[model samples]
Target chain A: MLEVRNLSVSYRHTWAVERVSFVLQPGQVAGLLGSNGAGKSSLIKAILGLIPCASGAIYWKNKPVTKQLNKVAYVSQRSQIDWDYPVTVEKVAMMGRISSTGWFRSHSKHSHLLVRQALERVGMWQYRASQIRELSGGQQQRVFLARAIAQDAELFLFDEPFNNVDSQTESIIFDIFAELKAQQKALLVISHDLSETLENYDKLLLLNKKLIAAGSIETVLTNENINKAYNRYLPVGNSDQRGFPSLPLLTNQKTPELQKSTRC
Target chain B: MLTWLTEPLEFEFMRQAIAIGLSLGILSAVVGSYLILQQMGMMSGVISHAVLPGISIAFFLEINVAIGAFIAGILSALLVVNIQKRSRIKVDAAMALTLTSFLALGVILITSLNTDRINLDEILFGDILGVTSSDVWRTVIITAIILILTKLFYKELEFYTFDPLGAKACGLPVNLLYFGLICAITLTIVASMQTVGVLLVMSLLVGPAIAAYLLVKELDRMMLVGSIIGAVSSIAGMYGSYYFDLPSGAAIVMIIFGFFLLAFLFSPTQGILTAPELKNKVFYWLRSLLN
Candidate 1:
């Protein structure tokens, strides 16, 4: 279980996120929902201690998270990674075990086995030897998912994982989360795809710079609450929106020719 | 060339120079690979040049240049790191301030000096052909020690460079690793100044790593390739300089630049300069349009 109370993050003088608070119980899948620049990434970074917290405290399993972080694992946005890096998919997955072995120790056969199993689980075993840059956007996300699977941590933090991934890969990854949930591992996912999160996550934390609503999906994702959090005077047009916007959908402005490829 | 290789061992200076160049190439390439990956190219340049003022001060006091250079490099690196920590100043600004100001200070100090005990030219452009045996031994010892450190802490360095946040999360002492990297880079720059000159130290620092990136797809392999290319370039540049009456440092830089240009033209993955049909067609169209 992870608990954050009054968590805040500031970039210089600007308060990017303020007085944000949320909790994820063991065996529960929690979704962090927000629009662009709404502090979803900031909150995630604060939870992982990547960025300094301005105020308040975070606790993992009742213990302070300031010093103890071995229980947590992070799968950042795919864009954060350098795809042209001279690394293979397998090598990237092995990085997950680095937290456990403490750099000096050689990667044991057990670690290699775990990496292979994670790749197989994600159906990325075939591309294990392929260079990272050669993989498609969805494939790159899968490779990262494989790394997270190798981490085998109790708490998983994913930031915008389904950005460029296909539904098939996304479903497979969500299935892994479901399995982890069955095993009582706590999962916190930051995703813009609301319908998918509504279907998969047990609880939702609607946020825009601060906590808008935190509870089960039914209680938090209401039209009124979303509008208030999103800071828009008008409604979002549809109560039960079928499909959330994908990255490719946004790229329609760049080249109108690419819109047809994104429809499927 | 084959006969010279066999006979070159007889001459002690040749042996010493070879050992110095080989070790320096190997160590610098190993570290340079990581530096390139971190996008800290400018940081390395800053640390390298900033050491010059430290050397000048050390020279005035008749102290060891290595000690002075290390101190100066570390302090400059710390300043850059701290400024990045506190201020909203971009890293480029910090690097520019530290490197240029220190270099200018070194130049002013050199101008103020009256003693013939230290010639500014020697420090600025290097004296590879005039390297003392003792300097060669010192270079060898330092290079070996650095190589050992790299091997011993390869995993830590890799993790820190690839993902500082993750390394910090794992309680891996990210700051210590960062400090260690700065020290290693400082040592390389100091040792290499004797051969490549302080002004052109970037050739050894960036050349081999960029070359290796062109040829390989794994970081480890890239390091190996970079080390080999650096060694080969240094030796070829030294010999070419010997034969053609060219400046040794500039020759080395030119060789590296030539290889970089060649790689740019021929590299399969990212070479903008090397694609065959695209280059010809683009140039032809450009010529026609201009006409």
Candidate 2:
């Protein structure tokens, strides 16, 4: 289990993420949804201790997890990596074991076996000797997924992984996430798309600079909540009524309700 | 051909120079492979020029110039990092800024001190012919140290260089690795100051490594091939200097440049001249235009 309390991240003088707090239970698949520049990456970075959190604390299994990076597996966006770096797919996957293998030592045969297994799981075993840049966008994501799979960490944090991937890759990743969840590993995934794919997550945390709402998919993803988070009049009604219920507009809440009642 | 090579080694200075050049070549190419992979090839240029201030300060204090140059090189690298952190200036710009300013400070200090003890030209261009047996020994020691460290920490260094964030997330001491890399680069620059001189050192550091990059897939192989290429360039350059009376450092750089050109055009896998894709594209374009 991971606990984040009153998490805040600031850049220069202004706050990018302000007073956000949430508890992620073990064996749960949580999704962090936000718009562009909505501090999603910043929040993930803060939780991972990649960037300093201005306020609040992060605890793992009731112990301080910040700076204890070895316990976590972080798969950054593929765009963050230099695809042109001179390395083979197998070599890239082998890096996941470098930390566990320790200093002044080469990777063990067991580590190599894990790397091969991870690559095969991601359907990338055939391209083990291929340069990383030669892989397609989805294939590159799979290679990165293979690296993460090889890590075998307790907590997995994926940031915007669905971008530029095919349906097959997407399904493969979701299956891994489900498998990790079944094994009771905590997972936090971030996505920008607002589609039915959000249904895969057991819980959702909506954000637009702050924690707009966080709860089970049914309660937190209400149309009213999304409108408030997206700050747009999305005209989303309840899922029972119009697929997903719309949030009451803060600007003219009384009018929409009155119109609904009159129509009823 | 044996005498052609054996004739030069008969002179003690020539033997020392060849040994120094060979070691320096291997060291620079191996280390330079890291630089090329990191895409910080120009960093060597920055360090080589930045050491001038340290040399000048060392001359003023009557200390070993190599020590001073090493200190100055490390200091300038730190300055670049500091400037990049505190301001909007990116790394390349910060490097360029430090390169010129540090070099200028060194020039001013040397000129103002009016010391006849040190000549700036010798520091910038080097005096390979003037290298003593002691210089050859020092190069050997530094080369061995670098080679041993690289072999010992190969996994960690490769991880840190390829994907620093991933390494950091894995709890590897990435910052320490980065600092160690800087120190290695400084030591290599200092060790190399005698043969290539500070100014021409970049050719040794980057030229051979880049050439080898075209032919290899792995960092280990790149380092090996780059070392061989660099050693040949340096020794041949030394021979060229002896027979043709050219400046040793300049001849070495010219030879390395020639190797780079050869690799660029003829490397089997990726070379422009050897790859069929370029020919196919040219023919296809001509056919389309004619149609």
lDDT by residue (B1-291, candidate 1, tens digit) is 787555655667666767777877787788889888888788878887888778877887888888888898888889999988898898899888988888887777766753335665766677566678878888888888988888888777876787676667666788888889888888888888888877788778888998888878888888898888888777777666556767777887888788877777688766775556677889999999999
Scored by TM-score, the top model is 2
- How well is each residue in B1-291 modelled by candidate 2, as lDDT tens digits? 999989999999998988998899899998998888778788888999999888888888888888899999999988987998888789999998999999889888888876546876777887677789989998899999999999988888887888777777788887788888888888988988888789999899999999998887888888989999999988898898888888888989999999999999998877899867887888999999999
lDDT of 2 by residue, A53-110 (tens): 8999999888787656777888887767877777899999988888788888788999
| Model 2 CA lDDT for position B94 | 95
TM-score of chain A of each: 0.88, 0.88
Specify the highest-DockQ model's number: 2
For candidate 1 chain A, which ten residues in a row score worst on lDDT?
Answer: A255-264
Error of 1 at B57 (Å): 1.8
TM-scores of the candidates in the order shown: 0.90, 0.91
**Each candidate's lDDT (Cα)?**
0.78, 0.84
Local error of candidate 2 at residue B223 (angstroms): 0.7
Q: A90-177, model 1: which lDDT tens digit per residue?
A: 9888888877776557888999999999999999999988888889888888888888889888888888777777779878988999
| Model 1: CA > 4 A from native | A236-264, B4-10, B111-116, B268-291
Backbone clash count for every predicted candidate, in the order shown: 2, 12
For each candidate, what's the DockQ? 0.53, 0.55
- Candidate 1: clashing pairs of residues: B265-B273, B265-B274
**lDDT of residue A141 for candidate 1:** 86
